[model samples]
Target: MARIAVIGAGMGAMAGAARLAVAGHRVVVYERTQTYGGAVRGFERDGFRFDTGPGLLPLPAVWRDLFLKTGREPLESHVEAVQVDPSARHVFADGTEAALPNASRAGVVAALDTALGAGAGQRWGDFLVRARESWDRTRRPLLEEPLWPNWRVLAEREPYPAVPHKRLLRTRRAGTLAEIGAWELRDPRLAALLESHALAYGLDPRTTPASAAVLPYMEHAFGTWYVRGGMRELARAVYERCLARGVEFRFGTEVTAVVEKDGRAAGVELAGGEAAEADFVVAGVAPDVLDRVAGGLAERAAGEVPARRSAASRLTVLLALRGARPEGTAHRTVVHAPDRDAELASVFDGAPGPSARPTVTVLRPDDPALVPDAGHEAVVLSATVPAALGAAADPGSRSGDPAAGAEELITAATRAIPGLRDRLLWHEVRTPADIEAATGAAGGAVPAPALAAAGGRLLHPANGTRTPGLFTVGGWSHPGGGLPHAGMSGALVAGLIVEGPEFRGSQ
Candidate 1:
């Protein structure tokens, strides 16, 4: 078996290590931080525990596949997930609130029709049906396969021309979210709502790809879920599974560089000049950071790097509230701005001034066992903000003042939820700088490869020029970000490493 070195210890690295270990390969995961989990890390302040990253959990089957492949069961031991009803409460500028149901297309349509107006539901249903078809046709060929030779093979097996008459690839790169929604949905409110969904990827609807329409479909069709404990528990579960599979984990050991022998990667050089050898290396850190670590490898492979429409960087506040559950508050809430375009422009322009109002998603742990008391609440408010607000002098350094940013975020969040400030017992804030420092993510990108830029032939790193033994994996590669996609990226890389070029050749 190969001596593999998995870098970062994030979900992607963890998944890769676990899978490699189960395959009987000697695997060692080197993490720069004192802890694992990357973006999924959690912390506590006062009597409140907060999950620092990934507030929601969807697609449980993805986790199941990761565990089952390693001879484990995620459902039986890892997480207790409950499907959320009325998945999210979206609040508009006119004070109209739409509680979206986590149900079938017809059920969702009925709810939308009742909430919005007559005929709106059927219109949405038709759109959903089309989106579902897009998802079904492309999920395996586009998302499941590695973006390398496999993509080409899959394309050949089912040529875009031969596939169902739906214009999947044709619409791959179309108008912005708002434009598409405006043209597709007749109602202005529904169009705005559809456009606003782009915020889920930290993107503005105006520039977001139409393919992103699949996001709402997946959430509504499969349902939005929450872990019984917290999202961080998912990372812990993966960590435990890795240990069971005999994977060696070394935390607090930062990877300073990827050492190369001739033209291929030999291993990694840890902080303070310690070096560990491996026949294969999979880096699960951000692409920009990976570019730096690989010593311009990313720049050299610039053509391969998926084009990115700048992803929204967040300014998040974690609040510990002492009060009974607030009435009319769903597990998730989205507060829309009067002009989302201007709001998004301010963030992108690095002028996320003190006055910008952001959509807030509050998570109240349903499991009594996870929290100390029913009166206490753990709330995380996140909104898109300027990257400069969280900038640091060094990429690897921790934030200079996280508390200051936290205060600013808290002040903003209170505006959306009245009396929110008064209820806070303790709080923490995470700026883009803080997230990058803590998780080694590029520009605090929660998930690498922003949704807008990942599409068609460019989805996978394996498709581009490759060094003899050097390979890349993680969210930065392709299918793109999110926990499930990252895990799948690692698996795809592993398959390529083991099976050679033929693995993804049929894609």
Candidate 2:
């Protein structure tokens, strides 16, 4: 069995390490941060706990599979998610509000019909059908395998007869959400609403690929769920499972390099000049950081990185409040911008000014145990911001400080939520720069790779290039990012590593 070393203690690293260890291979995970969950981790300030990233948890089966495969039961330790109704509230520019119900296509369609028009329901249904098809056609071939030739071979075997080279054409260009809405639905608001879903990835809908349109359908099909305590519990559960399976963890130990011998990965070198040897390595860190660690390999495989389609960075404000929860708000609420493009342009322009006034996503833990009392509330206000702007802001600025651009962001978020400023007990703002400094994510980006950049045949792991005894997982690798997708990517990589390179050649 291979002696594997997985870099980063994020879900991706844990998933990979668990699979490798369960397969009877020795595994060691090196995490740069003291915590286990990279972005999904939580911290407490003054009797209030906040999950720093990934507010929503969908596809529990993915996590279940990970735990089960590692010889652990997830539900036994962690809280089963409570499926939420009116999955999220989206407020349009025209002051109209709509609710996206949990796992109910008919409910979402009816809501859209009432908010938009009579035919809007049918239009949404049609869109759902297409997205479902896209998901079915793409899910296994793209998401379940390491980037290799098998995906292409499968596509060739299952091509649509009407379109002679449908699979080939599908991979050539990425479809934007706007393009999909315009081409299929012909409703700008509907298009904007669909595009707005790109916010989950921290991307502007205009630039995001149409394939992302599949996101809503996936949510509807699988449902939006909240873990009993908080999303952070999911990370803790996975980490514990890894420990149970004999996976070793090295927290707060940053990896400086991926050691290579004879053009193949041998192990990793830590920040303090320590080295650990391994037969295989899975990099759960940012692709750019991986590029740095791998030395000129990423440059050589520049085409593989999907140039000009990096995901957008974020500016987040976390608030701890006292008093009753706000009325007319679901567990999750999205305050939409009048013009998304204009708002995104400001972020891309690297200006210090507010971009689109920020999209406010308010989350109040349903469980009383998460906070001191029922009156206690926690909210996260996040918006896409230029990576450079965060770098320009002062790092030491505190709440209400004049130089803290983040403080201004918190003030703006408070305005969006009535009485929020007065209710605030404690608050902290995390700029993209803070995320970069804290987590070592390149440019503080959180897995927002453009769909267009990810659409091609090479996007699948089973069809991509590989170095002997080396595998890549997480958002930087094929099939792209998202908690579940990253976890699955790690599992697929373990399969590839265990099965040998000849298994890859078959496809």
Clashes of each: 11, 16
Off by over 4 Å in 1: 149-174, 296-303, 306-311, 326-329, 349-355, 392-418, 448-460, 463-465, 505-507
Q: Runs in model 2 with CA error above 4 Å? A: 150-175, 297-311, 326-329, 349-354, 393-416, 449-466, 502-507
**Candidate 1 worst ten-residue window by lDDT:** 157-166
Report the lDDT tens digits of candidate 1 across residue range 116-224: 8889888788777766765675676545676643344432232111112226455432344565565567676677677656675666566555656667767877788
Clashes of 1: 11
lDDT of 2 by residue, 199-262 (tens): 7576666655556666776787999888877888888888888898899998888889888889
Return the lDDT, model 2, position 86: 75
Each prediction's TM-score versus the true structure: 0.86, 0.86
Error of 1 at 165 (Å): 19
